[model samples]
Target: MELLLVEDDERVSRFVRRGLEAEGYSVTAAQDGVAGLSRARAESYDVLILDVMLPGLSGRDVCRQLRKAEVSTPILMLTALDHTDDKVECLRGGADDYLTKPFDFEELLARLEALARRGRGFSSEPPAVLEVGNVRIDRQSMRVLLDGEPVELTAKEYQLLDLLLSSPGRVFSRTRILNKVWGYDSDPLTNVVDVYIRRLRGKMRWDRDTGWIRTIRSYGYRLDPTI
Candidate 1:
């Protein structure tokens, strides 16, 4: 995922950039709201994280301006304000979500993932079931089926398959897979992704060379639904 982080505090910006980079997100940081606004207008990102307190312009104004300009990229506001009115203001300013200072990293990650999945803000629509070939997954129920038969999958396996299904025919690099499935703490050198891919194939009754899952020599894997 590509992200734009607008923050003034050096420490906070550094910490967020490092953490997101570790998770396979390409991030660009801006020190003030004006620079952030410029970058945001100039480039596209999967998401934007804005600090409420910023130099030159305030985060609320940035969000409001982006919305006014019809930039639909999801925005997550970070602030020390914890009051209900503060959160309402952030939302009213067009932020998709709000996170308070000193929050748990896990929560931040979860909210970002949720926002990305939700797409373009707090959408009210539910995700449609994803299917490729004979494999299908119901996002609402977290159910997987192979050839119309229910297939029980481990949480990790389910997540891996879901990622592939999310974008059929799009190759997912190993680093990207590791960060998305196993997280940043997983050893970069570990072959666990390979092992799990094999396991997922076996469970789905896919032969090594004749499956929808294709290994992209030395790169990673892709789900070729057309197969």
Candidate 2:
């Protein structure tokens, strides 16, 4: 999932951006309201976390203008103040959810996920790591672990694992894997898939007992957690 955070406070923006990125969600940030609004307009994001207090445009105005402009991406307003009217105004202005400053990170993630799910009917899972058998992938930190120990992998290897781990059990054919991981499909004769699979198996220490990656004859590969 892609997210845009429009916050002015450098400390807060850095903290939230780092935290969100670690959770596996692609995140882009803008320091102030004008820049935030422009970015949100120019690109597509699954969710937008906007601070109520901003430099050029207020978060409320941004929300109103977004709705006015027909941008329906979910907006979760952040504020230091927790007033009754503040909550009312946030919703009234077209924001989807609200979170106060100094709030719990876990709670923030939960609300953000919920709002995103409501918007797109997709997983809102963040801060929580994705697990497959003994392999754990943290989307936020882009960290991968095997059996509680850190396992080093190349960027492409991690992306491939992330793709497989994101949707377990479903077979990802070589062509699909190539298109997704490499962002383009080469000639059908490439042996890239087999090579990466070997590297992943070697690094992950897969075996008949582990049975992490399953070869479906001539079809493709799937992550079989049952192993």
Candidate 3:
């Protein structure tokens, strides 16, 4: 599933993005309402998660504008406001659903799944296979193949590779990678991400100079853009 998350809180964004990714949802995030609105307009997603309190424009305003523009994507609003009036206001402004602050991750997941179902009339899923260059993964089987040959990968390695494959050529910072592949609660100083990257590279037979996985010095990694 592809999701647009509009949130200004780094901690909250990191938390939700990681949790959803771990469950195999692809996420694109915007830190403020302006960027969020732009992304919503320019791209397509299975669902959108917008925080009520945002910089530049509020989530309600964003929702209203999207409706006015006929975007029609299912929207689930997030707000610290728990009152009936607040919930009603969100629905009135065109939100499909509403979640109160400090929500249970499970509840959020359920709500997202519900919205997806409501939109598609059934459960939506990621693509059956994701391929970039010679590497590909079967979303259902969680199996990877390189050049028609099966390759073995640990769970974490598979996740790291999946992340890289999801956005070919897009640079992912070490911190973002760590938070996505690992949990947001992981130790920030750990070298675990580097270790996993090396493991994935070796198993995939990554070429140091021209492999799909390229390391950005002092930054992080990305799949080869030209591939």
lDDT scores for all predictions? 0.88, 0.86, 0.87
lDDT of 1 by residue, 20-112 (tens): 776557899999999999999999998999999999999999999999999999999999889999999999989999999988766787788
The candidate 1 region of ten consecutive residues with least summed lDDT is 119-128
Model 3 is weakest, by summed lDDT over 10 consecutive residues, at: 179-188
**Candidate 3: tens digits of C-alpha lDDT, residues 141-218:** 999998889999888998898888887766777766776787663465788888888888788877767767788887
User: What TM-score does each of the candidates earn?
Assistant: 0.62, 0.58, 0.60
Q: Give me the overall lDDT of model 2.
A: 0.86
**By descending TM-score, how would the candidates be arranged?**
1, 3, 2
- Compare candidates 2 and 3 on lDDT and give the better one: 3
Model 1 residue runs over 4 Å out of place are 22-24, 67-72, 113-128, 138-160, 167-201, 205-227
Clashing residue pairs in candidate 1 are none
Per-candidate RMSD vs. true structure? 5.2, 13.6, 6.7
Q: Kindly list the per-residue Cα lDDT of model 2 for residues 145-208, writing each as its tens digit.
A: 9889999999999989898887787677776677779876545788898899889889988874
Better TM-score candidate (2, 3): 3
Error of 1 at 214 (Å): 9.5
User: How does model 3 score by TM-score?
Assistant: 0.60
